[model samples]
Target: MTAITNKGSGPIIQEIAAVIVENKAYLSEIDGKIGDGDHGVNMAKGFGRASDRISAEDTLTDAMQTLSDVLMAEIGGSMGPLYGMMFSDMADHLEDTDQIDAAVFGAMLRAGLEGVQEIGSASVGDKTLLDTFVPALEAYDSALAGGADFAAALDAMKAAAATGRDSTIDMVAKIGRSARLGERSRGVLDAGATSCCMILTGFADGIKTRLT
Candidate 1:
């Protein structure tokens, strides 16, 4: 297997920051219904820090570790742990190898999702990031199983994650602060799920941009 060089840190942070910045208002709106209404602010603030740190970092794992440190130490609310574990786990998984192939990339995403599940205590269909992440991971694996290339696999995963994020709009909250709203949480999007999709999209876009 040709070891695919990892997407560098700068693009990683930039993509994540761009998505959070672009969706700031929308994320805040979703958080308003079920959370502290500051998901956007807190996320942007944290990713901003991560992006700035990327300039000083040499590897993708370093970027993830830096993001983990910032999120764990500085941010508040449920996101801190959830996203913190995500980057941390991704970094850990990717650190051993100089590059990652499609199968390895699938495992990397699954590790991050597992870490988030560990922290958030949420499962698939919980109307959280798990909703988006789980499907995306599955889609990535399935695409690989179906003999897709890296680019094609990533495309499939992106589509699946976007669908998963959209599915949250009609779902009642089953976990997190949103669960307290009972059925009222329905009809509104899940901010975490939306951000989840954005992350996956950003990741895919970054890789595509680099590979192209």
Candidate 2:
């Protein structure tokens, strides 16, 4: 029966931004192995800016919209548009919700994934963020379906996200600049998947903290 109010949950997005900002170097390091090394720098810049725009008066939807706007318009790279659409879709799904329960949260996650798939060509095993994202959402949905509570479902999601991120390490890149590396890319983590894990876990932790 526990849920988190949309109101005052803007800080959850802020927390996500903070985590991205703090991990900028690590993300870039991973990216540098197979692609451009600017993943962290760009992600940190956009997320930090979004954090500044987030206000206490903003609801969860409002905060997500602000972040979506920044990522779509300001950041450069394929990630910008992909993540922009993801957040935009999530915010749209949650726009009228006063409380986020497991079902609502699942809808939001599915919406985000749909939005990303609409604009992205990557799929599971492509050595992209979808590797982490697809499994995380599925795990969350399965947990809810199996009679787990909201917090427990979130735990499932976070754990699945991490596992998915780790899975990317052995995968050969099938898209993006990394694809050119072929077998060379197999030993390193996909930067996008790593970042996706961070974002999903941040969301899980933030929502768990706000459960009422």
Candidate 3:
């Protein structure tokens, strides 16, 4: 299959909101194990507000920007600003494009990663969202380098995201509130990583459905 259109796809963004909102309970549950247990609540509130403002006529970039704006402005957690920058950076990379191929997708991913890194000190194996996002991007690049189609590359990304999320279960928290737990944090999954997997997988699946 060819690449998906770069024109804003409102439904895709809506689907992302839906996925986050639907999984609110799960996200908060995980966070309760290592954090303030408000990850899902804040995420649902931010995404829900964005969904309400975004119309079907909005472009994918438009929808992402709206979400970023809300997350950055209204939410009050590390995730709020982190995810706000991520979506904002992703939208920045796609704003002028009309088509998104595998390479374009990779660039967008890299931009989002950089955006998050700019504001956060977490790194790979820190039991943070980077655990999921970094490997997912790497897997996507690897799949494309191996001549895989966009759809196949997305599949590889999703698989790698899940693996990365799971890997966090055994990782000691190296940042954030969970770091206080020290060795105790190793038994449960990182809420940020878990939510990142959901977001990445949801995004890939949503875009795949729009592929030509």
Best candidate (score: TM-score): 2
Query: How well is each residue in 1-212 modelled by candidate 1, as lDDT tens digits?
Result: 32356645445666777788878888898889877788888888888877777763356677778888889999967888899999899989988576677777788888898898787777777789888998888898988899888888889999999999999988888998889888888988899999889989988876766552
Please list all clashing residue pairs in model 2, or write none if there are none.
none
Rank by lDDT, highest first.
2, 3, 1
Local distance difference test scores for all models: 0.82, 0.94, 0.92
Give the per-residue lDDT of model 3 (tens digit) for 1-212.
77877675766878889999998998999999889899999999999899999998778888889999999999969999999999999999998788888898899999999999999999898899999999999999999999999999999999999999999999999999999989999899999998899889988998898899
- Candidate 3's clash total is 3
User: Candidates' TM-scores?
Assistant: 0.93, 0.98, 0.98
> Which residue runs does candidate 3 get wrong by more than 4 Å?
none
- Evaluate residue 104 in candidate 3 and report its C-alpha lDDT on the 0 to 100 scale: 89
Q: Please identify which of the two predictions, 1 or 3, would achieve the higher lDDT against the true structure.
A: 3
**lDDT (C-alpha) at residue 206 in model 2:** 94
Per-residue lDDT value at 65 in model 3? 92
Return whichever of 1 and 2 wins on lDDT: 2
